[model samples]
Target: SCAVALEAVRDEAGLGRTVAQVRSERERLTAQLRGHGWRVLPSEANFILARSSRSVWLRDALAGLGIAVRDFPGNEHLADALRITCPANETDFARLTHAIDAALAPEAVLLDLDGVLADVSRSYRRAIVETAAAYGVEITAQDIARAKALGNANNDWILTQRLLAQRGIDRPLAEVTERFERIYQGTDDNPGLRMTETLIGDRAALERLRARTRLAIVTGRPRFDAQRFLEEQGIADCFEQVIALEDGPSKPDPAPVRCALERMGVSRAWMVGDTPDDMRSARAAGVVPVGIPAPNDTREEAERTLFASGAARVLRSLDELLEVLPS
Candidate 1:
């Protein structure tokens, strides 16, 4: 029996995002497509019908990977247009992004340390909560998240201090700084919070990426922290150099990104990162800024945030590098 069709424009509201959010996302996606050398048309609906000369080839390629995209060439104007339905949620958006990247392929990849190559939620975020609670301040994860949502939080110590001040409780810079360092870095007896860090990507995957093209680490972490993470995580062999916070001005300025590329002796590099500052910095430095769907953010949210911050692409995982870049 044939199933009866429902009314039009149904489910105008999505599970996690609204219709307007879908529109916004599609607009950003269209721009991203155009940025990557695809000829994209202005879309009015949640779905985008983009034009690429290799539309059919790419469509079949994605289909082979268990991903479906509509490529209809019977139409006159849209001879090689590919119609892709927008993802319903943030998570699916990231998956869609990965699929597209795998189909398109990238040249070089720059990496972000936290939230991309490593899960720092337990280590860094936990340290912030404990440090704030030590000063008799009752702060929740949601509160800290909101505080970080404010732009320019590359320095956690300064961020913590600002959050404390926002609560009308002003402490000496030294007091807040020392307490945060003690809990975050830990002493000989304390074991420190560094042990809480964990690798998010596979070692072999990174080795594969390194083999593909040049690799570097551009992070907001301090020099010692960056050094410890690279060496301890056994990923030091993966990158040519690390431009940490102490190396130059924090992100959104492009100084650190430029520093890394200059040190690596590369003329151009593609940047992979989780934060808006990372994207902004990459854009300013003339690097191709690619956003990562951070574990902490919804895929749609990360995509939108990064695009707004000038990212050209969004990726699901660093491991996907092996798939997104051609051998």
Candidate 2:
């Protein structure tokens, strides 16, 4: 068959044309990868080897997206490299690079659990208030808002501890957390404040948004809490992945957001959250940061903190993201 095919295009003109086209695409792909910060090596063959820390991960991610790239994970010298074969035409080449972009950049929607997905005013916020009162510190909603604006209060337990400290009531973190979780999760015989939670956006609307883009959770909640909330809300399947507290450092550190993106196997994404910490994390992870009003914050305060922390847009409702997402 190889001999027959060669004979069919045996003419020097046809052979030269094919060789020129392949060489052109190979050069184009190399240039494109280099422009995107990939350390692409000079190639005289059918594929280009590009060095990236994401080489192993990208190989797997692209495979999931139905594209193939070779990674030399077992080779000491090439373990950090991916060898991408050049596509034969401009259209396929365009597709190849687009997939690469999606893997290397934010391409999905990452969500914050407490404020954005579930209305936590009656749940987590109430837990904070009740827990502080137990420690003899009467912190108001405004105080919580102020604390959140600091961009390091993603952990409600820690926030409660800090609020107590501000009131001259320095409580042990373990003690404060014990009380906070008890109130939030409740005992087997008692209903917890978590029951007060409700979905911020309608199920149908979320489904619509999910249909339009990939969805995932990047929350400060422990994996158990996050999972329970999603399951109880009957929306567990809406997101592709969940990056919980156990995954890494909480919001404002960018670790959780990046973990979520990496788990989803795409780099580019938009993150919708309500706290300054959420905005900062998304921005640091190179994801578009969109903000919604925190349950305990006034619109003015929400706007001020969210924007200052790097929110590209502040939305009135989660559903508004459908309007904001690019078509």
Per-model tally of clashing residue pairs:
1, 8
What residue pairs are clashing in model 2? 105-267, 105-268, 106-267, 106-268, 106-269, 107-268, 107-269, 108-269
Off by over 4 Å in 1: 1-107
lDDT of 2 by residue, 91-118 (tens): 8777677666655554688888888889
The worst-scoring run of ten residues by lDDT in candidate 2 lies at 57-66
lDDT by candidate, in order shown? 0.74, 0.80
Where does candidate 1 clash, by residue pair? 90-300
Model 1 alpha-carbon miss at residue 273, Å: 0.8
